[model samples]
Target: MRTSRARFWAAVALAAATVPSGLACIWDGDTLAAEVRHRGYLVLDALTGRFDRLPPEYYRKRYELASERIAKDPSALAAYDNAAVACERLGRTDEAIDWMLKKQAAMEALPVHDRAARDDARYRFHANIGTFYAHRWVAGGAKRDDPDALAALDHLTKCMAINPEAHFGREVVQLGMIEWLNSERKQSLGDHLAERVMSSVPYAMDSSNNVLAEGLAGLVLLGAAWESVDVYNCMAHTLNFSFDSSLSFVAALRVEELLQSGKRPLDQSEGWRITLDDAASFWEDQYKKRYRTELTKVYSQLRAAGDEYVRKRNEYVLARLAEGRHPDSDGGFWSDWTEPARVELPDRRALTRSQFALVQTLLAGGILAGVVILILVASRVSRSRKRAR
Candidate 1:
C-alpha cells in the first residue's frame, strides 16, 4: 500500500509538471472532480476517505438523546422522528422501525377531533415507515416473501391515498422495485443500458438509468448482490447508466470478480450464499455478452487525473451541491421522488391602448439604441483591425 501510494503520487507529480498545455483546456476542474467520484473503480481505490461517515457511537448517542426526550415527554413526536434517523445512522434498522411505529401510535392517540386532519396527519408517518421498511428488507436479505417489504407497500399505498404526489411519488417507483423483486425477477422496473456502434450494439435501447436507478446501487443492498449476474444486469438496468459513473463500471466488474473467485466465506460473508466461482466461465461469458464497455480507455483517463482526485472531486461536488445544485438540480442517490411543484408564470394581461403604445415605443427605442451601439462598436473595431493589418 505504501509503495502504491508512493508510485501514485510520483505519477501525479510527474503528470502535473509534464502534461501538454492543451490538456489543461480539456481537464477542467468540473471534469476532474466528476472523474474522481468513481475514483476507486475507475483508476485506483488508494486515495483519501473524505466521504467517510461518522463513528457509530455518535449515532448511538443521538438515538439515546432522542430516546431520552421520549422518556421525559411521551408526546415528543419530533423526538421519535429523530430517533429513527439516529438509528439509521447506527444501522440499527429494527430500532429505526420501532421508533417509527411508536411515532405512529403516539400520533394516532393524539386528541385531534377532525378526521380530515387525522388522515392528512397520517401521510408523513406512512411515508417514513414505508421507506424504512423497504430499506430494512433490502439490507436484511433479498428474500422474496419478506413481510417488511410487503408491509412497506401497504404503508406507502395508504400514503398515496392521502397525497398522490408526495415525495415526487417516490413511493410509487419504490413500489415497482418491490413488486418486481416479489415476482422473482418476472417484473421490469427499469431497462437496459446500450451503446451505439456502426456494426453491433450490445444492451441496446433501454435508457439504462431512470429516476429509479439509485435504489439498488445505494450503499446498503447493492454490495450483497456483487456476484449475481442477474442482479448485476438488474443494476445495469436500474442505475442511471452515466458513461462516466464509477457505479456503472462496478456493474461490469461484477462479472470479473466472480470469474476470479466465487469462494466467499459464509459466517463472515459480506453477502452471498457463495462466491459463484464455480460458475465463473458462465459469468465471463455473460460479461462478454452483456457488459461490453471497454474499460481500458476509461482506466487511462481516470489514471491521468490521479488518485488524489477522489478527495478533490468529492469536496468539489459536495460544495457545489451544498451551494446550489443540490436538493433538486442533480437527481440524487436519495429522494427526489417528488419535487416541489414548479410554480407557473403569471398570466399575461391583455394590453390596453396606452399599454400597447408604451410597449411599442419602448420596443422601437430599444431596437434603435441596440442598432446605434452595434454600429459604433463595429466601426471602431473594424477601423482598428484595418490599421493593424
Candidate 2:
C-alpha cells in the first residue's frame, strides 16, 4: 500500500519547525533519576549492578506476597505499592491506579497529628498517582477531557507543597505530555509551554536527566500514529526542532527499528504502539537516504566517549527493544543488550580506552627497542673505525 508522501513530509516539516516554548530546565535534584533514562535500569541496576530488570514472573510473586501482607494488615503501605507495581507489570494499569488511590485514601484518613510525620509517604503517593493517571490518560486514547488528566494534575499539584524546596517540578515532562495530548499536537500548546520545556530539557541522558522528560521527549516524536505518512515523517525527524541539540533522539529509533527505526519512551503498553508494513518500509528507505549519516555521527561520538557512555546508549536501545517493540527479530544493534561487550558502529573504535592505551604502550616500546638497536649498531661501527685508525 503506497503512502501519501505529500502528507507525510508536511507533518515532518511541522514537527521539525515547532519548538518547545516553555521555560523548562534540566532537573539536577535527583542524580539517580537522571541515569534511569540513559540506561533504562533502576532498582535492578542500583542493587545488582546488572543491566537487567525484573521479569514478569518476579512481579507476579511480589504481588502475591504483598497481597498476603496486606490481608494481615491493611496499613501495610509498602505492600500496597508492591501490589500496584505488579499490576502495572501485568498490563493492568487501571488496577495499578486503583491500588495507588487506595493507598492515597489510607494516607488522607490518617490522624492530622500523624500526617505531618507522613509527608514522605504523601509525596510518594502523589508521584505514583500522577504517573499512573498520566499513563491511564494516554492509554485511554489521549482525549482532552480524560478524567485521568485532572486527576494527574490534582495529585501533581499537591506535590508542589509537600517538599516545596526539593521537588524541582519534576513533572515538567509529564505535564507537557498531558498538555500536548489535550491540544491534539497543535502549535498553541508549544507557544504556551515553550519556556517551561526548555528550562528542564536534559541535554545529556546520563548526567542531567528526568526520565519522565527523556521518556516524554521520545514519546512525542513517535507513537501509534506513524502509519499515516505524516506521522511516520514526523517521527523519523529524530532531532525534531522541539528537542534539537539541547537533547537528542532514540527510543523511537529502537521502536522504529520496528518503526522505519526510531524510538519512543516509557517501555510499555499497546495504546502507545506503532506498526505499519508499508510505512515502515518507506521510512526505512527515506532514513537510509536522509538520516542515517546524521544518526551515525551522533551515535559514533557517544561510542567514542568510552564504554560507560556506550553502555548507557546500549541500555536505552536494549530496554526499548526488550519491551517487544521490534516487529522483526533483526532489530540491528539494538536487538540485544551489550554488557562487557560493546557493539560496533560507524567510526566506533575497535578498542576500548584501556585497550587503546595498551596498544599505545606496545608501539612506544617497539620504537624504543628500534632506537636502542640503532644506537648499538652506531657504537660498534665507531669502535671498528677507531681500531682501523
Q: How would you encode candidate 1's per-residue C-alpha lDDT over 93-174 as one tens digit per residue? A: 7877788889888886789887776675576667667767877887888588789889987987787667653332244445
**Candidate 2 local lDDT, 1-389, one digit each (tens):** 11223333333333223222222211111223334542443211211122223346545666777778778887767667767766766778788889888887777666666655588677667766776787778777777778888887777667645743232334554455466666645332322233334434422111222333333332322111222322222232222222322122332333444334333343222223333222223233545433445544544444344336435754565565456442122335344544453332332212333453344345446666777999999999999999999
Q: Which candidate is the best by TM-score?
A: 2
Which ranges in model 2 have alpha carbons more than 4 Å from their true place? 1-54, 109-117, 160-170, 188-194, 199-258, 261-389
Model 2 lDDT, residue 85, Cα: 60
lDDT against the true structure, per candidate, is 0.44, 0.45
Error of 1 at 230 (Å): 6.7
Each candidate's clash count: 8, 33
Candidate 1 regions off by >4 Å?
1-52, 88-91, 111-121, 131-146, 160-170, 187-209, 214-235, 238-389
